[model samples]
Target chain A: MDEFASIHHWTGARQSAEWQQRRGVVLGIGDDTAIVDVGLAEEGVAAPKRMLLAVDTMVETVHFNDATMREEDIGYKALAANVSDIAAMGGVPLHALVSVSVPRAWGPERMRRLYDGLYACAERYGVAVIGGDTTSSPEHLVIAVTVTGTVEAALALRRSSAMPGDAVFVTGAVGMAAAGLHALLAQRVDGAAEAAHPIIVQAHRRPAPSVRAGRLLAAHGLGCHALNDVSDGLASEAWEIAEASGVRVVLHETELPRSGSMAAYASETGMDPLEWMLYGGEDYALLGTIDKTSVIAALELFRKEGIPFFLIGEIEAGDAAVELVRARAAGVSHSGKQEKRVQLAKRGYNHFKR
Target chain B: MDEFASIHHWTGARQSAEWQQRRGVVLGIGDDTAIVDVGLAEEGVAAPKRMLLAVDTMVETVHFNDATMREEDIGYKALAANVSDIAAMGGVPLHALVSVSVPRAWGPERMRRLYDGLYACAERYGVAVIGGDTTSSPEHLVIAVTVTGTVEAALALRRSSAMPGDAVFVTGAVGMAAAGLHALLAQRVDGAAEAAHPIIVQAHRRPAPSVRAGRLLAAHGLGCHALNDVSDGLASEAWEIAEASGVRVVLHETELPRSGSMAAYASETGMDPLEWMLYGGEDYALLGTIDKTSVIAALELFRKEGIPFFLIGEIEAGDAAVELVRARAAGVSHSGKQEKRVQLAKRGYNHFKR
Candidate 1:
């Protein structure tokens, strides 16, 4: 039932020399998005702009329920999640094909409202809703969106490009969406959590993907940068980059960024913000690594562009693994306060396992 | 709950100048597939090849049930349906993204079996299984596949290209799949239908899409041909071509091809084979129109390629509608076995309506 193991099994079974040697496939499965050379340019002309292909599916009870999501928010978040994958590949989304299995209970009005949200997001991102298929499901509603995007040839970000001595960075704050989900779930009990934390609730409902920041990073062409979207929590994503790149990643606990609202909500709910920051997912924030020498310029560029960028850790030359450097309490440490390195497990929203 | 009406309403609501005027969009919604320019060549160079995009979804109980479809067939047909769309557009499929929502009861073994069928189809068509998303569903299993393909810039067939005096044609026999389904369903009652009609049963389980035939028609470039796939049966597809092209179509009852097994099965079950041919759907045969002047050459080409081609009808100048010409029995006819023209309604497998 492990999702990753299942994916590995089928993907391995399907791989063949014919598929691997296909003329224009630059990169295939196991990445944020598949990179394809659409053969846009002529043989001797400039290299063709590569296309990024990605798909994401949202099921009724698995990804959302009526209590946690509105009909419109369900549609919006479904497409947004795929767009976030395009962003993680440092690409600009161009077209989308949405396939939805509607339950009869939704009727036509709710379906229209769902599309309203989809159109709104499409307008915001300048993507064309080209085509899709619609069918009725006997029970649950399912939405699967496939997004096609354009990325500069040779500049598309990948999870396997992080190198040793790279500075790991994150855009914007983490754990806001997780905190929002917690608050929404809490509303069922006290009925006050939603009104008390509107920002986090909205964050959970409609996460703004960091497409512009990702584009800027790709355009800047910083040294061997690796990029991934934090859809499955910071810990899981860091592990993805580490395992893919064959490098060790170290994330400093003190440097992990958190929104003020998330901190407030966490304290009010008597929860540890760090737990949400590391393990809670669906933030849609950008997690990446840049060479140490280019870190200063990258920070300056982010500052100039008014993008929230935080240096959270570093990539070290070692076996593929992710470690969290936590600051221990003074009394607990043998010597005064010391930093404790903890190996982080790959834990997050695993579909089958969950 | 009219599927076409719902599609029309939403597509109209979503249409905007930005989407309609997007740089590379050749065709958008309301077609077998969307055509995109992809900007392959530079300015003043040769025209770039266009890309074809299409998607189809199969939901449990709605599209199939355990009694009718095996897990592998479900996977095969889900992908085959989208590939048929690409064929209808005169394109060669290149890549596919599959998003599957599996119910917990199926387990990993059944899921892998489902993918086995998908990989078989992919390999047969020379398509790469580039990317996809997998998730858990609380109840029904849903499979959505999006396929990307390449077509000649100007030679891609369209439903709106039929003209007066065009000869309407179909590839292979019709109603075999529907007859197969009928036999399979009858097995529950009689317990002998499937065993009695293995050819029709196999046809229903694995309907082969006319990819090569479509490619030949596109390559021939025979006089502005209009093409469509018979996913929704002959009557419905004829209505689509008629409506899209603003022409009247007349299908001859005597010309409608039927397989021997289908005819035998229909007789045994006391079911009208013509009814199945017109309204049962999921045959995956190619239905198209070629200019009368080029019909001879087109037939010759098909003969040389050893592809089954049948001239079933003709296009005429009139308002958008489909008609069927049936010869009456000698004793019943008022004027000694005269031909009677009957208007064909748009009847097929409509998702919402069904």
Candidate 2:
């Protein structure tokens, strides 16, 4: 690892020129600092538009275990989390900086594998590895990634933009990643039990961010209002939108999307699938409200793009609050008792709250 | 620690509406992402100039021990390290995003103290705390901060611009921070040893980045050919400039900046003060080379600002290398023998290496 010398090794001349597509970047990496030529415009045009910035961190044990998670998956998910942030803003991710703390037990091979995963994920999303800091930890591994992207001021979406009568929409299914994580944690390091849960395992280990779908919504500017990626579960994200938009979000539990594996796991484990769908986090799906008038256009756009767009709820005129109606048939209790409709509590995985 | 909730409590709306000087910021914190209007200029004006971006990370034990380092000092140093990068690029830091991984043992009170330190350091330089990610860790405290700043395209300095005949200039003395850390680790947490070694300890725990000095050099365009903050000691940083700029840097041992405390500490410990001057790290002083013709202007500029400007070396024609000279009077050897001039090896604090 010392042969790497410093953080610059990954960001320096050794970095492949594959992700260097943005024309405004003057200097990408390999210096005491990185210089970005932001705000550039053609002659007679106004100054450069604002850039989107966000950062996310993944910790060992708190986020994942090396024993259950592959080395590359950790790197991929660490980077994907930040990419998802950029996508949530309806912007194109351009550059990134990663800071990693490596434990001594993880040898260079593991570090290389970890980086392999990171670079692979970066390449897929066209994000240049601009700069970063690397250091050794006496114990545990940690990664923090900062992503920067560009957005036209008028087109940028926010969580506060949703208004009354807006149709709440989500891209793709939710809760699969959480279920995958649960399956992994329940199984021993042995492969037999994991084989029974390949779908959840893959879903958990390598959640694909809806980057294309987000770009489509952002570019269309067609009725998309508030936008957010579902990292803290469907209910929690709906609550964020509801809180930021100063409106109420009412979701019919029957409309919550569930995968076949999730249903199977629910039946076999006697667990309520809706609970995972509503409260389990890290789905990386886009959740927001669109204008009811533009619902057809939005659905057509998503359909043409070959991505699922689920109409899960709607925005209403009320005090900023999130309301979930658990329908009578939503599920039976784990004890096999029929459940009554209820107001769902706002709770998601807040790893920091331990 | 759930009371702390997320990293946002520290970087959130509770954040004093301070440091909001930049005008083109479309959004800052409390959103899906932060949006900065880069390159904003008036009508008919050319595009806004470039923005500099950099990230730095500090880990527990590898960077500091909780027992010896105060909670606030840890937070301050974490943010300061990134600010130094902005300064090195000759940019005015405008905003920052911090990601912190906290261990439960540190507790909520310590976390609050850390944020207080971080915000205090940022506010002093007019840097806005825009956004951040906070999460729990199994062990160790970790901080990663990304700072973004603005610099005129022409004024931004690079690490690779030192040409032959350039006079190397450093702002203020170097190596005090390292000495301060040594004293702290050697003594108890009680204030006695720290009080006895005030300059060094403060230098170590709260090293200030020479933001104004860097801006002055870059803004004045005063023939400052290359610039970098001295974080990894003079020798290592000099090597970075030489290697990047493709020049030979020669330093006169006697001319190296030395404080009275450093000299006294060296004498009492039977160690060479030159070691600390050449190899001690984290001083956060600006080091660079200027055109020989501009020495007086540079000196006058620094004097007017009441900051120290020292000329300790020169760049010369040769393969990229850093050469240090030590005559017989350099120091008395342990056997009382006089030492000859030698080319010092390139070594400094690289925490990533095991």
Candidate 3:
């Protein structure tokens, strides 16, 4: 039997109604190719626009172990990571093409549930699952999703445009997803039972992208010169921004946001919470730098939505290097009337290193 | 060590200059998302246009076994399958996003060589390698590629538009790739060398998409009703057209083209060459229906380019079913009995059955 039998019927039968709401699609699915009509109206007339494209892949064991993670979670995370890429560019995702290779052991019900999860997340973002290819794999499942979105020419932010004197900010707490993964691996799920301080479990299973915050920054037309999402830890993303912009990114270690669940987990395990915040991946949090003048306005916009926005550092004129330091807080003066701090080297995940 | 280091550098390095030749790409690789400028000149003025999106995944064992297939060939086949989808739509492919997951055991140099093959193919097809995600796989390698293309509204052909009286045709020979694969598996590759026939070891390794052929068909604008690529054999694709168009597809089995390699191999192995012709997969040949009057013109156009196109079937007004029978040759007016033929059941590759 064809292993994709279930996926074909599931996606074909279930998604037809969902696809009707999607505008601008010339041919949605069940063809050699899926077509999307991308013309948008401007001043009562149609104007040509640009499209945003990105794809992400998640493999079994590398991303989620089949034993512990639910099939739906795998589907959700696969689409979420790609959505985060769009969020990093300050754009709205309009369509998605998902290609899956799986073992024959997976049945139709499981595939349907997986699509349910994928469709649920896509529905939340109003993205249409336009088309994809499905086939059998040798051993494990692989989910790769490609997303297309539209961006205003002027509002598109590049990672290389950060200017000196720009204030660095992050939309939400980082390292929580990493801590959740650690907890899952260590079987520490019991200790954080009913913990509301940090939505750690939710963080790893379904991390939300800072799409609205990113859009607000882009629309401000302030110095929204740089933007990126923290997928492979804060340090790795910070390095990306620094190298792309060719500017020095200096961060105050004490100012890095640590979630309550992460702090509690770190204390219980005798691990440093800051390390997780710096090196942990899959946070899906937006990190960017804007001119100092727009900082207050950006904060105001996020505050209205009850989203956490924190100022962590600044961009300085220098070569592409990032420095981490423990800066003294601006408070009471010591008896010696002096301030001292310690600097540490940065550490983050490198795909090249085993 | 990471298996994708060279892919990162290779795609990032070689594509910058190549992307300049590709029109409509605003931003290329090395970013959160790639942006494409899809505005077209309509009536000498710019008008918004539609974008075609498709994805295909090639998995180890399922598509290729590492012991027999070279790494570069694996990469070539992965991207070729996706390009064929775009070609099937009569569109020009603009951008591609590749997501690959490989075992950590694979070294960086091999990955680099694999990317070299991918880029070579992409350059030949005028496709820009935009952004994609790379991660480690739990076991085997999985390559998923997404392609973006643009189609003129009037030039786009659908698989469900075949008229009842339209004649059926196929571009080039079918089942050659399958024959090459069979030779490779049976270790008969050397024996076939003596025959000045087309085993075409390169056919399966680097199957070229019928992009030019499809474009010419669409541009003719001469009653080209339905269009589809012969990826899953002639019978399967013919059935797809029959089902989609709500018409009966009748094919003359005797008219199906079989290359010399296929005929020789079938005789050697005591296998039916006709079976391979009807059920062989991955030929990447174009199959569609056009008005009877335009068939000669279409054949002439292909012949001018030294390409082979054959008419072996026709569409009839009936329920969605396909019938295959031994058809008589032209100019045979015998006084004897004329009904000496057989009808065979349709069979092709199906994913579910073992």
Quantify all predictions' global Cα lDDT against the true fold.
0.84, 0.74, 0.68
Report how closely model 3 matches the true complex, as a DockQ value: 0.20
| lDDT for each residue of candidate 3 in A1-354, tens digit (9 for 90 to 100) | 111232233223322333332333333322111233345322245343346778878777777774335777777888888888778877777667778786777665576667767867776776656566777777788889988766555566667778899999888899888777766666645435325423676788787877787677768455677888888788877877887789988777767888877888789889878877888888988888989988888888779878888889899998887777555644433555433333334455432231
lDDT of 1 by residue, B131-183 (tens): 88988889888999999998888789999999999999999899898888777
Model 2 DockQ class: incorrect
lDDT of 3 by residue, B69-163 (tens): 57787777777777787777776766667777867666665666667677667767866565566677777888898887766655666677788
Backbone clashes in model 1: 1
| Tens digits of per-residue lDDT for model 2, B1-354 | 111122222223421233232333333432111224344455466444566778888888888885457888988888888888888878777667778887878666677678778867866776655557777778889999998877665677888889999999889787687777667766765775578888888888898988898889986659999888898889888888888789999887777888888677667767767777788888989889999999999899889999989998899988989987674566765777674445666776653231
DockQ for every model, please. Answer: 0.67, 0.21, 0.20
Model 1 alpha-carbon drift over 4 Å, by segment: A43-46, A189-194, A329-337, A350-354, B43-46, B189-194, B329-337, B350-354
Ranking by DockQ: 1, 2, 3
**Chain A TM-score of each model, in the order shown?**
0.94, 0.83, 0.79
> In candidate 3, which residue pairs get closer than 3 Å at backbone N, Cα or C atoms, i.e. clash?
A1-B352, A1-B353, A1-B354, A2-B351, A2-B352, A2-B353
- Residue B84: error of model 2 in Å? 0.7
The number of the candidate with the highest lDDT is 1
Backbone clash total, candidate 2: 4
Q: How many Å off is the CA of A305 in candidate 3?
A: 3.8
